[model samples]
Target: MKKIILLSFLAIICSTTGCKKFLDKVPSSFVAPENYFNNEKEVNTALNGVYDILSREQTFGGQLPIRHAVSTDESFFSYASFPTGPFYYNFGADDATIRDLWRYLYDGIERANVLLANLDKANMDEGKKSVVKGETLFLRAFYYFILVQNWGGVPLKLTPTTSINNVNIPRNSVKEVYDQILKDMVEAEGLVKKISDIGFGGRVSKSAVRGILARVCLNMAGYPLNDVAKFKDAATWAAKVNEYGEHALNPDYSQVFINLCKDQYDIKESIFEAELYGSNSDAFREGGRIGNENGVKCSASTDLIPTVGFAYGFVSTTRKLYTSYEYNATDASKRDLRRDWAIATYTLNASGVKANIAATNIYARNCAKWRREYEVVTPKNKNYTSTNFQILRYADVLLMLAEAENEVNNGPNATAVNALNEVRRRGYGKLLAGATNPANADYPGAISLSKAAFLKVIQDERARELCFEGLRKSDLIRWGIFVNTMQATATEFTTYAAMTTTIYKNARDAAQRVTATHLLYPIPILEMSLNKAMVQNEGY
Candidate 1:
């Protein structure tokens, strides 16, 4: 079935140019719905089209993650010569990146809608049909989730866009959009298969639906919605995944990426990921670009060789992120293993020797999680890579469970503490003997804190764990600290400016531009120009 799906996908891509011929013909040239979704194979082929949107550069491929990281304090453009205006929040309705993202998300939603509207009409097994319908619902809901979070309220185009009249639809309320998302998720949870049945993290499963539900519930429980009651629901959904027992944290965090780079999917740790198939030809560019955007620039032939000169030293880790790891009080050797693995503290010099980043060269602190060197086949073009971008991991599930538990109970409980400890234990390498070592070990012990204190801890923990993965901005927004955090980051940049030349000066200036108005990006100018009923977000 997988092979059939892959072949059908390639066929669709190869035949895409057929649309140009349709432009020259009359209305009769279009394929009718009855002719398209006729059987199981046709429906499956359509389903593959929906999945393909996720791999686009505007979606998970590049812009989405890059903009998310640069918009926050998690990362910065290493060189002032590179485009840094967007990182400084200088972009507005005319921004190309924002426009591309908006279009890509709606495109995904539309593809899902086309599949869903005709799913029941297809000739397929009852169980298989249900799986297809459920996957479409999950994909559509996921697209809306991203839209609502970024744009606040957007047009809720649920049905397949079959006519020109549907193009003028108005924007819905954030609450209305979220309501639809939760509805689809609830239905999807019951219809999707278990992870054991699929045997791959790329496909939607019941546990993935639950995990996303927990994430959605958390968003509702915060900022815009402020529905405190939803915290219990979040906890419930997260606990379900925790008890599912199919997913577990890989003991070695570094190995997870190594496996992904090798195109070896680990369903145990990565509950869901955007699949990227590498290729050496420009004609079939399907690989990921995260490695090129994040890896450090070096002149030596070491494990961390520089790829594209432009992107080689493009994105740099922020000082705040570099210092997020925990250190042993007495033992210098005992530190959070993820620190060096996740971020580059040093790089190979021209002599192939490790060189620590000095005050004069802060760009050396590049992100290492998506290193291109680990790829099984080195990409012919540095802009493309084979590494998969994880969407949801078991560690994220455990952390969400901890957060929701604390929010609902007004303090941490044994269940919540245990979940938090599990992640920390793995981060410290999960050694029973080392667990007791005060010098270098796991979480010191169970945490006891008030509601406010525990919530703060969870926020900090999330930044430390998920730093370059594109969740920081949304996390900060939900906590109602987006503006304040950026303001504080600006002050931190000033201190950093004192140690460097004009490079740090430009960064400090950009960081200072973050304000309350930036809480939600302006509704793209193009979108507003097209829809008369569409209103721009406040302070745009």
Candidate 2:
């Protein structure tokens, strides 16, 4: 199918890079500022260029999605162009992508600055200029957030077109960068009006800014080890998003994932999404990274899901998680229809659930999360036609709100509980799009969960709700229990019965426990080759 999509958005005083590989010696190709700001359209096109670069495989369209490679078992030595190879090695603090992330992001920074610097001269309506400014500020902060999260401290670039030559800039502490991020996003939060702009999917939005701010705060609260202040900040930002009232969870949870679903742009659940639409009819790529599997088999049958060996591996779920399904699943009323449809497992069929299908051809117990698509142009290529990557779902925001609020013990607060309940309600075929009391809370010695219990609930909910959406590993990291959980999950793969479970352990850990350093990926090799001044992190 020829999927039609256009990505652009509302803006006020906003605006927005690349060079030949050899000519890259210059920090940037300076176009005369006079000629640069020739028209409002010129500035708009400049920002479009930013979107263009980000959509490249090197950034979001392809390579960035593989971020799960380091976290999941669904990967192996890519016979193809492997962009994230360094991550698996536990590459140093200064790898190229790390540095390229610096450069690519700065490239965005300069573009945003250009717009902000020239906002006054723009010929567009004054209202439009403010919208543009809001967008630019959001983009700027968004890029910096990516930087600080990945590289810790990075030199801040507010608006330095005067000296593109300043390559010797020392790194700013992570805290400083975060401060800037907060400042810019805060401004963005105010300036962006509700959008009716064309092509808004994946474009920045008011709620998107709030969601990122909340997420950033949440990360800061947890990363580098949990800080009480960070938690407070996290809660505050999350609350800001909820309080601001720009979004809500859709009534249906599965509606969030199905490619065929409409109102995708209108779905209250999508705070932000990556827009992917392809209508190519080309032959399988020869030299270039065409469809961006990065030369690796993504969710390869044996690698990610459905492999008995991989299933039983420690990465597999414990009987604990499986039990969560037992509690929440609708299969008891026609069991397999609910759980069976979510995760693809080999089992025989029964009323409430399907028994594990007995078939050797069964690749593994895998998540049905992947959107398997058929080829359009070239018959050989298999594509996942889903246009929207649910990067930040509205339900997640609600649950996050619930977590932050509940942590303070203020209340499961009606609204917060509503948000959490909404997810389960949709999943279990209920109307209420919020959390509810577990049926017979005291029944049959229920798994007692205190405040911490919600954490596990969220984590398992991630498994059931997100699954193969390229989030589990990061969730594992953020939940702050990758090593223990992943290790136990890994060892579970050792037994015959466990093969269907994700119990396999990654050998990288030798029992001393994986360090927080593992969370930050090393900069790419290319970046180190380019910037000698860039310091490498210990243990490449």
> In TM-score terms, which candidate is top?
1
lDDT of 2 at 413: 50
lDDT of 2 at 188: 85
lDDT of 1 by residue, 1-540 (tens): 111123334234212222222111111225655567778888887787777667666677665676555646777655666454466677888787777777767767766776787788887899999999998899999999999998898888887654433335577999999999999999999999998788888888988999999999999999889888999999999988756688888878888778776778778888887777654244445665766666655554443333421136556677787777776758654667787777876665565465777744443577777765566664335466656778888888898999999988889888787887777777777633345543244344446678788777778778777777788888888889988888787788877645365556666666778887777778777667656677888887
How many clashes (backbone N, Cα, C below 3 Å) per candidate?
0, 71
Model 2, CA-based lDDT = 0.49
Q: Report lDDT (Cα) of residue 184, candidate 1.
A: 98
Worst 10 residues of 1 by lDDT: 18-27
What is candidate 2's CA lDDT for residue 92?
49
Number of the top candidate by lDDT? 1
Prediction 1 TM-score vs. true? 0.89
